[model samples]
Target: MSDPWLPSLITETPQAGFELAIKLSRMGVKMTQPSDEIRKKLRVIYEDDADSLIAASQVIAINYQTVAAANNCWR
Candidate 1:
């Protein structure tokens, strides 16, 4: 149910859309995926950026992995 006191336009706005991903108020705001053209453009723009970020972060991931000796309790 919508609030009767609210402006009518606010309630009607969402129906005009292309598509939405999610709408839960708690998890986060909704997002729409980029269209094919935009997705290609974004991939071109960020591919190098992603490679650099991965290279920058790889050492931390390597450092953070556990060096656990096998726990033989179950055997």
Candidate 2:
């Protein structure tokens, strides 16, 4: 089945991504560096506006959920 959480991150905010990453890390999820282009996109989204932080947080939460679900599914 397709993961529902992955798309949520794409739609969420950067701060959300950070928060989600933290939560996932606590749950033993590993993180890898995003590509330069991806990083550039993230920077553009976050650096340009303060209100976008909420979206960032949502992205993170979705990412965390995706990771957790994937791990569980594999196990």
RMSD of each: 17.6, 11.3
Task: Specify the highest-lDDT model's number.
Answer: 2
Task: Choose the strongest candidate by TM-score.
Answer: 2
lDDT of 2 by residue, 1-75 (tens): 324444433314545555556665433322344366766666676666767767655666676666555445233
Worst 10 residues of 2 by lDDT: 25-34
Candidate 1, pairs of clashing residues: none
**Cα TM-score of candidate 2:** 0.34
Which stretches in model 1 have alpha-carbon errors above 4 Å? 1-31, 50-75
Q: What is the C-alpha lDDT of each candidate?
A: 0.32, 0.53
lDDT of 1 by residue, 13-63 (tens): 232111111122111211243366765666576568977557535533332
Clashes of 2: 9
**Candidate 2: where are CA atoms >4 Å away?**
1-50, 73-75
